[model samples]
Target: MDRRFNKHEKLKSKKLINKLFTEGQTVSAYPLRLVYLPTSLNEANTPVKTGVSVSKRYFKKAVQRIRIKRLMREAYRLNKSTYFNNLTTPHAFMILYIGNKKPTYLQMEQAMNKLFNKFINATHKATSDEKNT
Candidate 1:
């Protein structure tokens, strides 16, 4: 894979976004919360599609919100391979930055790692339960 965060990898469809938020499962690690739905929304070649959001209610300024989102996306892009390699199905994810104050990249990266681990575990468990039944 290219390991690049490109336009095709971005989750932008309004309909898909609505379904992702409404029907998805949530996982949180401190400042970050991920809402994900396991479905094949992306093309056959792309295994996952992701969206990032930082609340204006918390950041107030557009610059602050954009900065936080940048950090979040960078963290996720670097660490997403681990998630994709282990997945049994494609997932649409919305990563929400919920912190009230600004956070450093290291802090956000750690939180992103934790969130991904939690998500992987949850998906693994769900698949195993399905196999047993």
Candidate 2:
């Protein structure tokens, strides 16, 4: 199983993030803002790069921030394989935690999974509708 989501593949550039926020489709599942754009990487067989951000104000202590980020990352790593398998095109994904307080790993993981499932279903429906039309 491919388990690495490299930095270069990640939507890390600030400019891209800004553009996506401004123009990309958005779905809010509380704590998670899923911003996605339909695009592809040049590399052959590359999984879409994803980034996760937690608000600093919500997590004042570095330890809390790190813990949340780690939980988010692990959840994404485990659940993202299903997303990759189902997606027909390459896309950029951003998982933004927009909560006002730190959450436990289990809480964050559940939220992330819910957000991801919604995104995948919506995207797939959109793609299928477009193809049918």
Candidate 3:
């Protein structure tokens, strides 16, 4: 697997970001809130871009914040392909960590996958409802 996620793959549109936070479906798992946008550009060359962050308010120690950010990035990298394959359309996301303590790499990845699946299911349900309406 290519370890690089290019610029286009990253979700960078301000409008999309606003929509994601305001109108997008959100799924939470203790340390993570998976906020996703459902529209995407459908092209094979488009690479997925991702951004990782740790809140300093929750983690005062710089070391702790860095470690959590690293773990989050690794988790996203590993499970990203799964997310890519599962995309119903082009989507944007931010995986915010809400837990107090940092978790192991495996733990983060598992949480990510679980949260993503939930997000996808929610998206599907919403779409179905819209179709019926």
Candidate 4:
């Protein structure tokens, strides 16, 4: 599976982002919350497109917020293929840093693994339920 997080995989559309907050469901792992919406994306080459967000209210500095976002992106980049390689559905994800304190890269990476695991289980269960119904 491809491990690189290229520009095509970065979520940037404003209207889609707004719809995501309104219609998306979330899977949370403490400091990291993954808000995801399954949708047909404009770019057919990418199965998932994601954006990272760190709250200014919590970080209080652009530098701090930027660092957190970087950590989040790195964590996602490493963990993406492990859980999503078989994903037939495309998704848009907003990964929000919901913690008040600064996090180490190690912490972020571990949380990201847990987050993706939880996401896979949740999506699988949802599909199974739909089939059962």
Which candidate leads in TM-score? 4
> Which digits, one per residue and each the tens of the lDDT, describe model 1 over residues 1-133?
5568888889999999999988999999988999999887648777889999998788888999989989999998898876676566778999998889899999999999999999888888888899999
Q: List the residue pairs that clash in candidate 2.
A: none
TM-score of candidate 4 to 2 decimals: 0.97
- Mind giving the per-residue lDDT tens digits that candidate 3 earns over 29-128? 7788877656655555553435566788889999998899888877777777766665555666777888877799888988888887787678788889
The prediction achieving the highest lDDT against the true structure is 4
CA displacement after TM-score superposition, residue 124 of candidate 1 (Å): 0.6
Output the worst ten-in-a-row residue range by lDDT, candidate 3.
Answer: 41-50
Model 4 sits at a Cα RMSD from the real structure of 0.8
- TM-score against truth, every candidate: 0.95, 0.85, 0.78, 0.97
Backbone clash pairs for candidate 1 read none
Name the Cα RMSD for model 3: 2.8
Candidate lDDT scores, in order, read 0.88, 0.77, 0.73, 0.93
Q: Residue 7 CA error for candidate 2 (Å)? A: 3.5
Candidate 2, 25-93: lDDT as tens digits: 987888878888876566557657678887777688888777777888887887777667756677777
1 or 3, which is superior by TM-score? 1
Show model 2 residue runs off by greater than 4 Å. Answer: none
| Model 1 deviation from the true structure expressed as Cα RMSD, one decimal place | 1.1
Return the lDDT, model 4, position 100: 98
